[model samples]
Target: MSRQRLEHYLEQMTLDEKIAQLLQLAAPFYDEVGDEGQITGPMESLGITVETVHNVGSVLGVSGAEKVISVQQSHMKNNKHGIPLLFMADIVHGYKTIFPIPLAMGCSWDIKLAERSAEIAAREAAVSGIHVTFAPMADLVRDPRWGRVMESTGEDPYLNSLFARAMVRGFQGSDLKNDKERVASCVKHFAAYGLAEGGRDYNTVDLSERQLREYYLPAYKAALDEGAELIMTSFNTIDGIPASGNRRLMRDLLRGEWGFEGVTISDWAAIKEMIPHGVAEDEREAALKAIIAGVDIDMMTSSYVHYLAQLVADGIVDEALIDEAVMRVLQLKEKLGLFEEPLRGADVVAEREIIYCEEHRKVAKELALKSCVLLKNNDVLPLNKNQKVAVIGPFALSGDILGNWSWNGSTELTKNLAESMKVISPSNIIIAEGCSIDKITEPQIHEAIKVALKADILVLALGESSEMSGEASSRSNIKLPEAQLQLVQFMKQLDKPMVVVLFNGRPLDLHGVYEEANAVLEAWFPGSEGGVAVAELLYGAANPSGRLSMSFPYAVGQIPVYYNHFNTGRPKPSEDTTEKYVTHYLDIPNAPLLPFGYGLSYTSFTYKDLVLSSNEINETDSLQIKVKITNEGKLSGVETVQLYIRDVSGEVVRPMKELKAFRKVELAPGQSREITFEITEEHLRYYHSDFSFTSDSGRFELFVGPNSRDTMNAAFRLKK
Candidate 1:
């Protein structure tokens, strides 16, 4: 059906049916029904009442296409108007063909691949009868301690923009109306949830307009530009108002300013949490505030379902507001092609065939390998096949492979790194669980040291699990969990050369390991194929190319560290320097353990001679900058050539440097490549007071290199 036809169909629905369409119901874990039906979980549960069949607006926590179809059909069976329910799930990464989490994919710096991954996710999700995916979390993070940062694309607006647009395209496809299985992308956490207070999950966000526009908000606009059909508001508040009930954010900026035509959704129980935010007296008041603020759907919240109509009856909320929100909700269901064939999408054969296909695994492996950044290597990496390797860590044997926000991740069929290595090279592998990820005993340390003594090579797997650091799992200190670090220290006592394989969700402090490990590979929470990918990189099957998207702080006390930090009038030059009255810390440095865009490879690549074709430009002029890179080592490698531009001064205090453009290039040993970056006027524009974007002419600096810290700089000037 056309958008016109869908709109007409929605207009024809009755008020009760419209209200039913607006409600999103809660269900238990999916998998109760056989093929050919939408399996609403309550049908098989013990406490289900007759009201469940009639009053359920939608179903949550569902799976399988046929089961969803059965559940939706069941929902319509007892309804007066037979309105089919919207089936929602946390399809954060992927549906069945699970891709890498957004952070790891962000590390890849390959927008096309990210887009393709989403495309496959959308295809698999849609085929399974899922209408929407709560994905492309576009929130920007400066604090790596925030566990949910793992869910975001990364800290840079430019990188987030590309990934957000790609994910939106992947989920929505070319058109949702014609594509039977095309799922709508939901832009999440409406505003800056990334700068959560002290890096705690679901904490408050406090940001100035200058910071909000310059740092956050851009990726959201980009997703909106790409036609994201739904949006999930953050639990975090902007200023003092919770995002779910913040009318200025949801209504003013999102709806009016950005002109987003889609429905706005509350994160799970976020509307109810407004009471905790102190904005609402109770759940009833929370419902009133949220609907008044223009929220269209309440996910897993009884706030809207239990009290929205009551709020209308009490005149606390205008009926027109309900109509407007209900309209958007019904309109989105229409966009999902639900109106034309409400009960026809569930396909058992598609579900059976699509989940965990070889192609998906190949893509998963590619993304996994691409995400493994060689942070440091001293000619000890790319292990020889003949070497005897000892793999140590609790995670190596545990079923804790997947990172955060994984909907259905399991290690049931997965080969842990130790097992995977044996498959690739049978005779040279040894497995030993040295220490737990958390607290460890002295005997564990003794065992680890013993393993190192007998081994020619060691691969230490260390990082957080899928559960330890996401959503409710924020950590104050984002170092490797204590026990494992002690094990690393113990292993360092031995003379055997070792490699540190990090499987973390956030940028962790590897300060101590800088001197201890011979080689370090950042294998950020790679999904199912994580082990296989790590094995390949360790054995020289794949070269490490991924780079850090967020800066790893030296300590959590240096919370909001990044490469684009502003220069204080009296900026501290170095950590060694003392502070009399200047901005310098006595114990810790202001700098991160590693800067953003930081990554290393076994093969050394050198960047030289920054070049710019035009320094002065207008809205119409294009600035071209080039940098020469040579692969100085004896292997083929890939490099992400980053171009950063800094505006000396502006109408607003600008970041020290903003990522202008970056391109990933492939080069063989002894080969040279010149990468050019096109800087348009839009790249220089900043959101001014009154929200109008304007640029100022000034002397600017251009830098290009392996990472933000390792760059060669030059100057250019902008003209009026």
Candidate 2:
């Protein structure tokens, strides 16, 4: 029988069978590690049985093609409906081949690399039994305090949009149903979940409708356009409704208006937590709300399996809702070719041998190098081989180089910064554990201070752990934790040259580092080969070109900082000192430590003469903006050419500027290129006051820059 006919026949079975089809259980990853190194704990002992799994439609965390096939054979051996279960994994960066964490990939700003990484992840995952990935988060985030910024691209909707599309295409490939290596792409957190209040994880998100459509919605829509097969609801609510239970966000905006013909899944255990969200009175109400809102999969929440069928029978939810969800899941399975020989691509030995393969490592290294943002360089970097380098801080020798959220990476397997630097220049490198991360005791501060007096240079590796900034990880103070600040101050007292290599998961207030360290590298948890990558860049083996996709704040008090924030009528410039009756804090300036799109390299470049192809254009026409960039330094280097546009006037006031396009350009010394970025009416479109997307007849300003703050401007007009 055809897969469609089988799906139809299954739909005709008892409501019990339909409920079984929508249920998915957590599956354990086959690779075993010691208790401390495992990414997640076992779900096997949670009263899970083959009978329960047989009643489920999908399984997550299960891999190894042999294991997948074995499980399939078991399902066929006992599953009453005889349905094949789909396997999913995080598979964010790469399956087992450690790549630069997603934030590091953001620094590369290369869609092709993102796509290549995803393709490789798919290839490895497919070898085992994985068919779906909860990746390419595509959430437009600017708050560095929110730890998952490491998983997203960055603040700008445009760059984030491109990254999102690339990731979806990479995961899904050209055709998903027929390609074994290609898994279904799940575009996540459907709406404005990124704007969590106070940069807190799972916090309330309240955004204006224009802010919602103009910034957040585009990336998800772009990912969907690129054929994302699943959508995951965010942990937060839009307004007062948790996204999992909101009909407007899930059913209306996503499926009804956007036409996303895919299964909507809740974030792990979200469906059951609707009671805590105060949206539902009980688990039964939560199940009804989520299903009615078009959520198909419950993730780890067994609430759907326990209460959904009864909800339908009680008339709280329609049987049609069940059918709608079942159809989407079946269609996706058919797309994956699961109906015809479910184990078609299953090759357990090949999967085990190939996962985390070497070539993926090479790509990961290249990406890691690209993601290292040079925040500050005062002619102190490009270290001379003759100079003795004093590497100070707990992060120096602690091979806990694996960034946060690495499920299975251990310090034993991970390379420490000291080791990678030793590989670079063994004899010249000195070491001292300045202090532990948040270690208030400062037992070794004297040793670090002593090393500082003798060494010609220093590399201070200090930052938070992988777990310090994800999921429930929210910080009230995002400064260098504890003695780290005191150590930097102590090192500064030595009057020697130093570079602070920060291995943090979030953007931190590096005011102390900026004052003391000669150079600063914001290495936001470069994964696996991070040590090697940072060492190479520090030694001038690789020119530091990674730019800050998110803004760095001066303090956690300046939370929710970004480049495109709406300009207030009483706009306070950096120099504005009128403390009386202004939208300004009496003590602090309304500016971040490092503006968005800010990153520095060894060599300097200058942008001159902003020119447009034409001053005016219609909605369909393209306006070309060009700038001549000179590599005004001795060393050859790369520059990320950024293009930002502003709506001078709108029905609703727009932000000062919005990032439209950017490109990473490599130039030899004395070489100049007039790079032209094409701007279209499509780029001009923004959500209007009435919730309609339209481009208006208005004067627009084009801003070109090394970073958002360092910019040159010109004007153009777009007509109806």
Candidate 3:
């Protein structure tokens, strides 16, 4: 399965066989039994036949060792060259032991943990016969209205880039040649899929080329730099061209400028979608554009299978392009060692032994604990074990904590808050299902209140169900569900200390519930052992250290609010005072309900004594900034010290602040640590108005604090 052999195999392939390698179908196409197993969503209409299915190079959405074995055996029997069919699935978070969603995992701010999660996912997925995972979705999301925000890391380009590298390393590992536990990583939605217009799914994205490079494209670069094996074209159009067929994006930028040699695949029939996108006249034209644009695989589409051979025959498309695309596909199979053993890691014994095993669940539990963000607290957390506790809400005893993209995971394994808490103190805990997620009845409220009256403390577990957040689930109004809000209002009348444990996939506008609850914990779809993790935080077994990766808007009016927003000509007041003509919201404050990088712990850390090695820095030189942090509160905790920088003056306007660097440190009570950050010219450079990625000689402000909004600051000058 060497390069030489791959080339030889390509040379022996017929025009139709080469075209077959560029086409990918689903589990249904391989079903020889009957039409019952056939997925007629779009394939049947495409006129794909048994012959075309036999020649398909890869299969999508098929898992399990037995199923994959059956499919591969059937495919190889008919594949004249004996090229193995690549098995790909959307194993986003975890395979069996579901971990926190990507957004929540980003909140951990622990890159090592993020890497471990991907590694675990790779191991579990590989054993189940999945050769590729469309993961480490390196899209930078700012608008919460986008339902797919749950799939991305967060809003910051720098943070997303860091996570992108970590996940790639975790998925592919160091050596794909020898690694059995790793699966190939496909860094997806190649260009700005997160910046959909109106914050709607698959909407058009329009941005200046400068803005594209400055804010969106960095994460994809980071992933590719870390050796991601493949790139998936986004569903949206860049400018006016669909990403799957945009030659400027695929050939000029990705292949020409970036020098990416990996295979590029269209995202779930995106090539055929070019017709609906108004770029192509028909499937023939779509196939020509995609293959010419260097797309190696047509995922779940028959555009290549139906048109490519004829297009090549008619001289509309070159056969060399077909060979190039087919070669890349074969090269990936060689790299994955699928050419050597068709069933690479499909060991049924290993699949059974490793899936949701105790070791895997322990890591899942640890990640879930680290991902829970403490949004607000009023000396009511760390509930006393002896105190009578009432766990009242829809999620209190429900096992629906596993988030989206948990393909092979089981909710049956998920523990509820009440179930986990009962293990700590069976005699002191009372439980009641207040109401359904979006429903509240008088009888349900009365029953919840009856249980609340007997308890010294009330833990209200609330928020959206798992279905309300992932793909195609965008919301115009991000407020709490009406029935859940009603339940909260009813519980407010109980006069007991209440803590709100929220389970959501996106950042919510918590206007109504934030004021009524004594403490609020953003659990954010913690997976598998989520309930146990929440119980641990409630009883002081684990200190909550997760920070907000995406800003929680104060209201839905401030939809696209983020930390790194450019200043306007007419700026709003920095203070709480109102101004008539200044840029300010008429109804709500300009700030978010909770700012980015904001989180609370059982303990507290105070920062002081900011000192710089030099007040001035040259273009080639680096400056070191030192800050002292002390754990002031009683309990031990982990504190994420965040560093932000802002250009005082530029050719164009600059954001108020941009996160450059951060570190998470664990400290015991009364312990002091000095954190140092090295700032260089590279950190100061940005895409100028004229598209030059260079900085001007100017004064820069540096802020070091717990969150973006509250920080101690200093100023320095950069001498060119």
Candidate 4:
């Protein structure tokens, strides 16, 4: 399959055949077995025929080598050209051996581990007949009310960019065409879908060009730079028009400026929704706008399949656009080696052995270990295994730990908190379901109190159900459920040393549990091995090394609070300041309850001896900064050393501090290491008022520390 061959095939396709090649339908539409396999209702609703199903370009939401082979064989038999069908799915976190959600993985801050997780996910998915994965979202999330925040890495562009590249490399590998165990990466929700208004899913997004370039666009560019194969258009609007039909976003910027020559597909029926979005009058206009805006594939929409050919025949839309879109689709199929081997890597035997195997489970456990952040501790962690520990809450024995988008993962295969604890200390662990995720009864409370009274230590497993976060699951109040809080209050009266192990998707307010518990572990939806990982850390088998990627607000009023925010003219003077008119909350603190990069380990680390090579540097030169970190505590642990820089003055307003670099160091007791970071001119660059990315010659401030708030500071100067 060369370009000439693809062109020859394109020349042979009829108008209906070409239009069919640009439409993507789900798995049920193409099932030729019986009435059970066919979705007759949707088929009639979309007005598609059997001939159209035979000629469809791709299939989504279908797996298993047997089913995919059956559908492909049937489709090619009826399809006159015998072109292979591309299979895509939302393999977000993991395929079978589920790993932590993207937000939890970001807290690990280990690029190599992140890449390995994606590699395992691809290996499992490729064997099951999936060709493309809509994952590594690359959306910079600031507001937690957005249910899709679980899909994003975090709030910072630089950190998310690093992870975006790791995921792309992991999913596609070095050579996607030759790698049978890898799947094509589709970095999704192009251009700021995470900034949805009111932190609601599919809400409008409005930002300035400069603001978009500065903070929102970097991660997407990073993914494309890493050679991702496909890009999915977002559902939200950019500027005024929806992203799927916005020419400036898709054609001008993504294809023209960024030089992305890959296939572009609309997010689930987004092109058809443009009619209701008030941008298009009907499906005919929607189809016209989407294709002209450079959307190559219309997902789950009849707009392209039913109307594209008519638009071209009417002379309003050029046939070249259809040719180009079809050619890109064909080129992707060829690149995937489908022309040579139509059933590329789908093997039933391999799918069974490679998915949820022992080796993949080990990596999932390791990532889970690094992702559970120790939010609070008053010397009650690393509990003695000999002590009688009561495990009580909805998640104590429940297997809803594998968060959202884990469609292929089964709860029965997961080990819950109670099971893992019993494995470590069978005789010393007692379990009770004190309350459901959102409800509790009087008998349940009484049973919980009785169980707590018998144990020396209480390990309350509590948090939101898996449904509380991840796509279309937003909540206005991000606190623990009222019933669970009441359980905490009743248990607090027992006066036993209590530890709260939270399994959640987003950063929570933690009002009741934070103040009452002696220790709090933020085990955010820690996938298949979440139970084992948290249990190990509890009994000194492993250390808590995870940090917070997103900030935890003290109250819901502080919705958008983050460490990288800009300074205000009427900024709050100080924590102790009693100023009347400063930008301080009347009843709450301006700072978040837990800031980004904030976490606690079993051991302690100290930072000192900050040194700078020189106080000033020119544009072509680089500056070297060094700091010494020592493991002061008796136990061994990992520490994340963060580097931040502040531009004193710029043509436009700038953040108080921006994360420039970070490195994780492992050390034993009393071990000291000198960490060095080199800062070049590129690290100092920022988007100007006119959207030009460049650095200014001015005084700069540098800080190095474990987290955002607690840091050692220095000064420098940048000269042009």
Candidate 5:
């Protein structure tokens, strides 16, 4: 349908019908609508009539071709204009063939693989009649205490921005109108929901516009730049106003400054929560403020449906605003080609054939293989196949490996550690559940010790369950359960080679397990074929290449530790410094247990002979930075070469180091390669005190290395 036709539909809709177009309800509301157009079931409490349900713009949390087809058929029969309903769901990482969570995908540092995972998710969802997926959550996360860190890529804005664009391209593709295998992408938590105060969910977020623009907003802009079809408002308050009702944030910044013409939506029930947030006095005010703030869809909220029409009638809200919001909804449906084919890609046969298929599972396994970060290895990894291995702990046989937001993933189809290890070395593996996640008895501990004594080595599988992270699951003490720690202490008494395999959602404190274990593998809730991938890495079928996107803190007190932190005036001198008066922790080091971009490969690589094409460059010119990398070990492996820069002096303080660029290369034993990176003025730009984004003329330092903490540095100058 053309713009003129969409406008025509807007003109044809009555006030009530137009108001309904701005409201979004769950699948249960539509499922209970009677044939005579009366509310009969779940929606009765909201006082919503069947007529309002018939005109609802979209449905949430519903899928499968049969259910979607039935609902669409019923809705069209009652809808006066016969406009099709849009189906949206939380297809975060994958729809059915579960892949690793977004944080694990970030650790892989493979943008193409991330895009491929999104493509597979789109294929499965489109076949099941899902038109939009609330995914590619681009919030820049620095605090691991926030449970939703599992949903974000990492701490660095540069890396997260790259991933945000890749996810958008994967979901929407080049032509969403014609591609039946794709679904429109909804980049979410619109502004910074990750910086919630104290890392609590839905807490207040207070930051200067300069701080917000510099660190948090870049990833979201990157998503919009990639043409993501929709943006969802965050639940937190930005500068004392809820994001759903902040006109300066939504209308002035997102729509005005960024020029994002895409649809704007609220996170589940965020529009109505403004009253509790003390911003709106009643539902009428909530509806008025949200629409004026450019929110087009109120998910799971009755405020818009009940109060919008009356507010417009009383001259409190403009009818033009309602027309604009309704027009955006109609334009989205037209972009989806809903007029020509009401059921865009709904086919029960296709849903069965495409979802959870072998091809999709292959990608899941491959990504899982790359997502496992080998955090520590004291020469105990790449175990020999003939060695007798004891896989002990709660995760040994548990199939709850698919992390949060995997609603469609089946635990029955997921492979556990014991199952996959047996397939790799069937005759030499033993298993025992020494303790549960939180509790342990003497008999269970005795049996676990007995099992450990029978094996040549122990693979201690442990960590938080799926409930520990994602959404409202934040924890002040981010450590393993006490029972698991006690289990580790008991296993350490056996004096055997121990490899701690973590199945978790966020970066952990790892105090007990890190010091006691011989090797530690951060296998973050790897999805679907997680077990198979870990087994392959254990036996040397695949090498460990995944790096940490988020830092692992030394202690819980250092809650928000990250690599690119700003240098304080009274900074700690060095590890050997005896200066107690400086800004240093008395008990622990000021650094993280493991830094960002930190990982290990079975094979080793060495960096040498860093060189620059020029020592000084103007704004228009670019500099070529080069470094030599060699595989110094006797195996083939992939290495992520990272480049960082620092502004020696600025109008405002600058970070100690910022990741500017990075590259991944595979090298065989004794191989040498020189990688070159081009740095332009764009990479150096930062928001000033006036909120202007530009680079200043100053001296700079550049560092290139395998990780953030340990690197060789060279000096350069930036000329205006």
Candidate 6:
């Protein structure tokens, strides 16, 4: 249908029908076989009529082509207009063939891989009758204690924004109106959801608008810039106002300032929670505030369904607001081509044939390999295929490697490390579960040691469970569980070579684990094909190329440690001998155990010849910078060349270094390549003290190398 047709349909809607278009409900509300009381329990509790259910704009958490076909057929039978309901779900990582979690995908530092993963996910989800996926969560998370960090791309704004754009392009392809395998992307947790207080989930956020614009808001804007069709309001309060009803945030900033005409939906029941947030007196007030604040859809809430029509009637809310909100919903449905074909891509035959097929599984396996970060390697990796290997730990034989937010994925399809190792070293492998994840007895350790004594090498597979690091699963202490550490302590006494493979969600304080093991691989819950990928890396079939996207702190006290932190007035002492009156730690080093972008490969790379085209340049002229990189080892590898910049002086305090651009290049043994980056004036623009985008005339320092810490540097000037 055309825009004019959609507008005509919108004009014909009654006040109740228009208000219902701004409400979303769960699958149970429209279940055909469920009991009447069970189906309507949520409605009765929220005081919504059954009529509102039949007219709802969309449905959440429902899938399957048959069921969606039934619901759409039932709703169209009761409604005067033939508008189809949009189906949305939390297809965060994947629908069936689960890929690595978002954080792990960030570690890959390959934008094309990230885009391909989302493309595959969209294809799988569309066949199952899902129209929009609340995914590509572009929150910039520096604090690992916020369990939702698992769903975000890492700490860097530039990297997160890149991933955000790629994910959006992948989900909503250029031809969304005609694409049958695509779904609309929804970038979520609008306005600083990652900066929750004390790194707690749903906690308050208080930051200057400049700080908010500079750091937290760019990723969402990047997604919107890529034409993301929807935005979900965060659950947290921003500067004493909840994001769901913050007019300045949603109306003035998102719509007026950013020109984002996409439909804005509330995060799961966030609009109704405004009552508990002490901002609204009741559900009626909540609905009034959210509608006035420009929230288009109330997810899983009756506040809008029950009171929005009455608010328009009483003049508490303008009727034009309802028209605008309903128009956006109708526009989205038209773009989705729902009116022409109500069951847009709902084909039962396609769902069965494409759900977890071989092609999707292949991409999942490659992503699992690319996502695994080799944090430390001491020539002990690339173990001989014939070596007598021992796989021992809590996760050695467990299939719990599929991480959080994998709603449609199953662990039953996942192979354990021992099961995968059997293919490479069939008769010489010994496997034992050293202990349970959280606890271990002496007998279990003895059995593990006996198995370890028989093998020449040990692969200790361990880390947090999938339930330990997502949504309300925050941890006060970001360390390995005691049982795994104790098991490590026992294994350290052995003289055999040890390799520690971690399956976790967040960056862990792995100082002790690194000390005990000769080699460590930070494999953050590598989905269904994780076991095979680990085995391939172990036997030299695939090179280890993944890098760390988030910094691993030395201790829990350094919770918010990141590479892009601002320089302090009294800088931390570089040397331990002069620690007095400085920001140095008395017990540990001030640096992270492993810095951001820090990862080891089977081969080594050397950086040299940092060059700048000019010593100074005007604001309009592009500055050229180049560096030489050489693969000095015998194995072929992929190198992620990172470029960082620092302003010598600025209107506000500047970070030590901020990542500007990165390139991933493949190099053969003894191969050398020269990479160049152009710095435009736009790259230098940052939010000033007055919250205006401007650049100050100053000297600039540039660094280029493998990671953040160890780099080759040069100096240049930016003139007015």
lDDT of 2: 0.81
Answer with 1 or 6, whichever has the higher lDDT: 6
- All candidates: CA RMSD in angstroms? 2.7, 3.4, 1.9, 1.3, 1.1, 1.7
Please write out the lDDT profile of model 4 over residues 447-528, one tens digit for every residue.
9999999999999999988899998998899999999999999899999999999999988888988989999999999999
* Alpha-carbon runs more than 4 Å astray in model 6: 33-42
Could you tell me every candidate's TM-score relative to the true structure?
Answer: 0.94, 0.94, 0.98, 0.99, 0.99, 0.98
Candidate 2 local lDDT, 134-187, one digit each (tens): 887888887877888878888888888898999999889888767877888898
Candidate 3 per-residue C-alpha lDDT over 322-344 given as tens digits, one digit per residue, 9 for 90 to 100? 88888888888889998889999
**Lowest-lDDT window of 10 residues in candidate 6?**
32-41
User: What's the lDDT of the predicted structure labeled candidate 3?
Assistant: 0.90
Task: List residue ranges in candidate 2 displaced over 4 A.
Answer: 1-3, 8-12, 28-50, 440-443, 573-579
| lDDT ranking, high to low | 5, 4, 3, 6, 2, 1
Candidates in order have lDDT scores of: 0.79, 0.81, 0.90, 0.92, 0.92, 0.89
Better of 3 and 5 by TM-score: 5
Off by over 4 Å in 1: 1-17, 29-56
Candidate 3, 19: how far from true, in Å?
A: 1.0
Evaluated at residue 619, the lDDT of candidate 3 is 82
Put down candidate 5 lDDT per residue, 83-195, tens digits, no spaces: 99999999999999999999999999999999999999999999999999998899999899999999999999999999999999999999988999999999989789999
In candidate 2 the C-alpha lDDT for residue 677 amounts to 93
- List the lowest-lDDT window of 10 residues for candidate 5: 32-41
Candidate 3: stretches off by over 4 Å: 31-45
Model 2 error, position 506 (Å): 1.0
Model 2 poorest ten-residue lDDT run: 30-39
User: What are the per-residue Cα lDDT tens digits for candidate 1 across 519-578?
Assistant: 988888888788888889998888989998888788778878888877878888777886
Which residue window of length 10 is worst by lDDT in model 3?
Answer: 33-42
